[model samples]
Every structure is written in C-alpha cells, then in structure tokens.
Target: MTWSSMLLLAVTVERVGELWFARRNTKALLSKGGREIGKEHYSLIVALHTLWLSSLWVVAWNVRVHPIWLGVFVCLQALRFWTLATLGKRWTTRIIVVPGETLVAAGPYRFIRHPNYLVVIGEIAVFPLCLGQPLHALVFSIANALVLTVRIKTENAALSGSRHV
Candidate 1:
C-alpha cells in the first residue's frame, strides 16, 4: 500500500474504533432515559461519512500526501479528541439528551455550541486535501454541509427545552 493508502487505513481503523465507542455510549445514554431525537436523518449522516471515507480510499490511494494539509488534519484530530473528552460518556453519534441534564459548558463547548460538528466539517474537507484530493474535499464538504444543516437544527430543537449551557 502507498503512504496515502496507509494513512487512509489508519483513519479507517480510528473511525471504526470511534463507532464502537459511540455505540457503547449510545446504549448507556438510552438506558439512562436519554431519548434520541432526529432518528430519521441519522442514516443519511452515516451514509455520507461512509461514502466520503470510501471514496477517498478509491481515489486517493495512489496520491501523495500533503504535509501542511496533514498537519491541519492532525490539529483537527486534536480538537476532535478534546470535544470527545469534554463530553465523555455523554458523547454519542446520535442526539440523545438526558432530561434534567445541563449542557456541557466546559472545554470547546465553552466557546462553540457545536464543537463536534465544527471538527467534522473540517475533517470532511481536510482529509481529502491532506491526501492531495482537493476535488474530493470540495464534493464531500458540500454534502456534509447539507446534512449538517438538518442535523444542527434537530439538535438545537432537542436541547432547547433542556438547561442552558
């Protein structure tokens, strides 16, 4: 495998690990009476991410990695880890709000209402660019924006009645 392919493989493994962690968190949240909102659009989000990653593997396999872009991607991962760590066990792939729970106001959440989404937005674009696939970056970025439009609205509505951040 080429270097780009190896990087993609590492990313793929990281994503699978995240999915496993999210699943465990989701189960725990649901068990604690956290009801999920916007279930209908969840599959679209999953499909978009899956296709984005899969397409990169197909089109960027032979491409050379861009050092600067890879650096940006690394920074994004750091932000991602911060967001996840801030949320801790409350972090799930889906919007599941536990009633009576206050929104987390620590870490990145202190500044951005949706820090995780911001990180994802960057990733959707930067991952491709780092692999020397700018066109792929643009295409997936647009798709992700469309999906996130609906997602953010749903999330906001779900948390609207809850305690303030």
Candidate 2:
C-alpha cells in the first residue's frame, strides 16, 4: 500500500484504540460525578478533524506522494499517539473539566501546556503537505487554529480555578 494509505490505516487503528480507552475513562469519571463542560466544542473538534482528514484523502487521491513528507507525517502521527498515551484517562475530544480535578503535569504536559494541540497543529500541516497540497493545509490549518484558540482559552480558564494534580 502507499504511504498515505498506510498512514490512514494506522490512524484509524489508533483512533479506535483511543476511543475504547476514552470510553472506559469517561465511564469512570461519570461514575465519580464528574461533569463535562464545553460539549459543543467537542462536536466542533470532531467536525474539524473530519474535514482535515477528508482533505488529506482528497489531496492524496490526485497527487504523487513524497517519501520525505510521508516520513514526517508518520513522525507527527507518532507524536500524536504519544500525547494521547501520556494523557491517558484525561484525554478527551471534548473540553471536559471534572470538578476538583487537579492539573496533569506529567508526560508531554511536562514540556507543554497543550501538547495534544501541538500534535494536532503538526498533523494538520504534515498530512496535506505529504500529498503536496499546500492550499488545503493552509486553509485547514487556519481553521483549526481558530478553533484551538477558543478551546485552549476555555480549557485553561476551567483548569486555572481548579487545584493542581
């Protein structure tokens, strides 16, 4: 299979694993009376990521894949996985702030306040560029940036008022 196709397959598998783990985490949090905030933002995140992935597929469909770019994309994907694993039960597509929960300072959080967002920013550009679609990358990156700005601000506000983990 082509590198792009292989990347897609790997992403699909990883997302499935993430979903399974997230579900378990969600259930545990909910059982503990944890409340979720900014649910609409979660939906927006899903939509934007869907658009980004669709654009990658569209660009890859017509263009010749570059090996160097594909390699970069793979690395970005690995970063994404690492971020997710680091976050563990704390990771969610939504901005859920469990009441009284402490901030996570370990793993990727040790270096960046929002490592997952960093990975997402990289993926938005990396995948499209791998397919030689700078236009799509530009558009989607801008859109994702705007959405992330709102998300980060809200999430920080939510966490700031809470105690440290």
Candidate 3:
C-alpha cells in the first residue's frame, strides 16, 4: 500500500481507539448524570461523517495519489492526533453535556475553542487533495463547514448555559 493508504488506515485506527476511550468516559459521565441534548443534530453529525468517509475512500481509490500531497495528508493526520490527545477523555463525537462539568481550557482549548473542528476542516481538504481530487475536497469542505457552523453555534449555546463556559 502507498503511504497515503497507510496513513488513512492509521487514522481510522486512531479514530476507533479514540471512540472506544470516549465511550468509556461517556458511560461514566452518564452514570454521574450527564445528559445528551440535540439528538437530531447528533444524528446529522453521523450522516455527514459517513458521507465524508465515503467521499474520502472514493477519491482515494479512484484518483492518483501524489507524494507531496501524501506528506501533507500525514501532517494533517498528526494534527488530528494532537486534537484528540489534547481533548483526552473530554473529546466526543456527540453533543453531550455532563452535569456540573466545567469548561475545558487547557491544551488546544487554550488556543482555540474548537480545535477539533479545525482538524476536521483540514482533513476534509487534505485527504481528497492528496488523491488529486480537489473537487471532492471543495464539495465536502463546504458541506462540512455548514454542519460545523450549526454544531458550533449549538454547542456554544449549550456551554454558555452550563455552569462551565
């Protein structure tokens, strides 16, 4: 397999690991009275992510992968790892509010309120562009941006109402 393919596989593994960790944390939080809001929006998040992954796979299989672009793709994947590591157990794919939880202000949270989303934004372009599919990048980037805009607004509002924020 090419480096790009390997990098993509590694990312998929890391994502799975992160989700496993997040699930454990989420269960603990729920046991402590954490509540999930915006169920509908969360569902939309799943759909969008599915589309993003599908597009990435399609482009990866159908287009020619370039070395420089592959290198950039790896760098972006590292950034994604950074975002996940920074968030630790607090990182989740869903909009869940743990009751009485304080806002996190350490790590990447110190520099930007939503570094995870920034990673997402970068990946939407990096992956497709690596495979010489700028059109895929452009199309999905726009869709991802729209979804993230709504997600940020809702999440920020939730944070504002919380004791944290």
TM-score per candidate: 0.97, 0.86, 0.85
lDDT of 3 by residue, 21-138 (tens): 8788778777778876666677777777778776576557544668787788677767677877866776777777877788877777788888888878888887778777888889
> Cα RMSD (Å) per model?
0.9, 2.0, 2.3
Ranked candidates, highest lDDT first: 1, 2, 3
- The parts of candidate 1 lying over 4 Å away from their true place are none
Between which residue pairs do clashes occur in model 2? 103-165
lDDT for model 1, please.
0.94
List candidate 2 stretches off by more than 4 Å: none
TM-score of 3: 0.85
Kindly list the per-residue Cα lDDT of model 1 for residues 52-89, writing each as its tens digit: 99988888888899999999999999999999999999
Q: What lDDT does the true structure give each of the candidates?
A: 0.94, 0.77, 0.75
Higher-TM-score candidate among 1 and 3? 1
Candidate 2 lDDT by residue in tens digits, 69-88? 77887787777778888777
Q: Please tell me which predicted candidate would have the highest TM-score against the true structure.
A: 1
